[model samples]
Every structure is written in structure tokens, then in C-alpha cells.
Target chain A: QQPVQSPQAVILREGEDAVINCSSSKALYSVHWYRQKHGEAPVFLMILLKGGEQKGHEKISASFNEKKQQSSLYLTASQLSYSGTYFCGTGFKAAGNKLTFGGGTRVLVKP
Target chain B: EAGVAQSPRYKIIEKRQSVAFWCNPISGHATLYWYQQILGQGPKLLIQFQNNGVVDDSQLPKDRFSAERLKGVDSTLKIQPAKLEDSAVYLCASSLVFQGLNEKLFFGSGTQLSVL
Candidate 1:
């Protein structure tokens, strides 16, 4: 099943902080985060596997909560370059563990 | 290493017509995927291939959608009798491993399909 993401869109200023959440009804083996600029392909940011595993890329970090079947992405000191649509792909981890992406959260970072 | 490559950045077709999208995955990558992303939505996996063999296609509409990855290097997704709802961006992605769920995915620019 597709995971559910909160706060469909968010606006932030330079040096500001924001959080995006992704939740799944079933247990997830991993959660991958990606950012896509307008008219561009999505770029891989980080992936959180299992509970307590934290992944970071510069000022962006993500944590996986296995018990809650949720993942959270944190953006610190947002920059204009951070403006993009963020997507969370949840993996159920069967034999192959195919990733199923959730509806994205749009982030607009301004000066 | 080069990322996934897709052709015909954009396509426009009338309803009931047919369209195809091509993808060239990163060399040596055994896992390839095709996704459909509607405006304002996330990329939805349409099919997956493990070295030219079918793995999963639960989300693909078998009646009108078909995909193949011959020689395990490139893939093609075709839609026949396309409907208005079929308009979306077709994205191609590849990974280094077939069972590594957390591995990074490399995506292509995607083909924008517009059905009138």
C-alpha cells in the first residue's frame, strides 16, 4: 500500500527548519527520501533502514521508526536550493523489497 | 557512472492512440523499474525487472500497458488505446542490486505524456 505523507506543502525562509512525515499502515523495511526540482528528475537524498537508523545529507536528516511504521525528514537552515517536491518511498521488504512511493510534499524555500 | 536515460522528453497523443517510452539503465545494473507520476503525485511503480526477467507488475494495467527489458540493458513501456487518464510522466529508474531494498535509485528525466 502507498504510505501517507503529512503537510502537503510547506514554505520556509533561509535558515529556517521544517519537518516532513511519512507513515505506512504496514511494517516497512526501509524509507528512502528524494527531492525533485521543477522539471527535473528526483535526486536521492537519504534512506533510513530499521528503527533508530538515521541518515543525513548535509543539513538534511531522516529517522526511521519501525514500531510506528513512520519516517521523518528534517531540513535545517533551509536554502533556496532546497525548494523542491520531497518524496518518501516505503519498502515492504518481501523477497525483493520493491519500493512504493507516497504522494510527495512540496517545499518552497525562499530568501 | 551515468544515470538512467529516457527518450522523447515529451509526447502528446489523442485518446485511443498508442505511445511508447524507452529507457536505458545504468550499465551492469540488474534492477530496472518503470513508474508513472501524475501531476502533483509521487512516482508510482508500474513494473520491475530483474535482469530482463519480470519480477513484479501488480500496479500495471495489463489491458493497455506492457513493458519489457530485453538483454537486461534497456527497457520499453508501451500503452495501447491510451485513455485520457493515462497522461502522466513516465520515469525510469535503476539500482545496483535486485534485493537491496535500501539501495539508492537513479532516475531519468522522464517522458511527459499528454493524452487529449
Candidate 2:
């Protein structure tokens, strides 16, 4: 099943912060975060496993909570380059490599 | 290293027509996947292949959709008798492993199909 994403769209000025959430009904093994710019392929940002360890790339970070079956991506001091659609792909035991993605959360960072 | 390669960035076809999309994954990548992304939505896995063998195709529409990866390198996805709903972006991605904390997907720009 596809995960649910909160705040379908968000607008922010440069230097602001934002949080995007991804919630799944099934227990997850891992959560992968990706960002896709207009007319481009989705690019990997970071991944968080069930153990609760958080990973960060530049000013972006993510956390996975196995107990809650949810993950959250955080953007600090957003830059214009951060404007894109952010998607979270979840992996479960039964799904194997078939990662089901959530409806993306569109983030628009203004100058 | 090249990320991934896809052919015919854009296509327009009528319903009941047949279309095929090609993909070339990164060299030495062991896993390859095809995802369909509709407008205003996330990418959905259509099929996956590991070294020329299918790993998962549970969501694939077997009646009219088919894919193959020969020699564990390049792959192709074909759709016959296309429907209006089939108009979407076909994305190709590859990874080193199926499971792991560090597993990352490298994607191609994808082919946009418009079925009339």
C-alpha cells in the first residue's frame, strides 16, 4: 500500500524550515527519501532504517519510527534549490525490494 | 558513472496502440526496476529484475504489460493496446541491493507517454 503524506503542498521563504511526514499502515523495514525537480528524475536524499538512526544530507534529514510506522523528513534553512516534490518510499518485509512510495509533498522555497 | 538511460523522452500514441520503452541501468548494478508515475503522484513500482530474472511483478498488469532484462544489463517495458489511463511517466531505476540501510536508487529522466 502507498504511504500517506501530510501537507500536500508547502510554501516557504529562504532560511525557513519545513517538515514533511510519511505514514504507512504496515510495519516498515526502511524509509527512503527522494526529491524530484520539475522534469527531472527523483534523486536520493537519505534513508532511515527501523533502528531509529537518522541520516542527513546537507541541511536535509530524516527519521524512521518503526513502532509508529511513520517517517519524517526535515529541511532546515531551506534554499531555493530545495524547491521540489519530496517523496518517501517504504520497504516492508513482505514487499522485498518493491518499495511503495507516498503521494509526494510539494515544497516550494522562495527567494 | 552514468546514472541510467531511457529512450524516446516523450511519446504520443492512440488507444489500442503498442509502445515499448527501453532502459539501460548503471554498469554492474545488480537490481533494476521500472516505475510508473502519474501526474501529481509518486512513482509506483511496476516490476523489478535482478540479473536478468524477475524478482517481483505482483503489481504489473500481466494482460497487456511485459518487461524483460537480458544479460542482466539493459531492460525494456512494453505495453500493448494502450489505454488512456496508461498515459504517464515511465521511470527506470537501479540499485545495488534490494534491502539495506545504505541502498540507494539511481534513476533515469524517464519517458513521458501520452495515450490519446
Q: In DockQ terms, which candidate is top?
A: 1
Q: Model 2 chain A — which ten-residue stretch has the worst lDDT?
A: A91-100
DockQ of 1: 0.84
> What is candidate 1's lDDT per residue for B1-116, written digit by digit as tens?
78789998999999999999999998989999999999999999999999999899988999999999999889999999899999999999999978477689999999999999
Off by over 4 Å in 1: none
Q: Is the docking of candidate 1 incorrect, acceptable, medium or high quality?
A: high
- Computed on C-alphas against the true complex, the DockQ of each candidate is 0.84, 0.69
Q: What is the C-alpha RMSD of each candidate to the true structure, in Å?
A: 1.1, 1.2
lDDT of 2 by residue, B1-116 (tens): 77899998999999999999999999889899999999999999899898899988988999999999999999999999899999999999999865443588999999999999
lDDT of 1 by residue, A1-111 (tens): 899998899999999999999999998888999999988899999988885468899999998888889999999999899999999999876635888888999999989
lDDT of 2 by residue, A12-57 (tens): 9999999999999998888889999999999999888888588899
Relative to the real complex, the DockQ score for model 2 comes to: 0.69
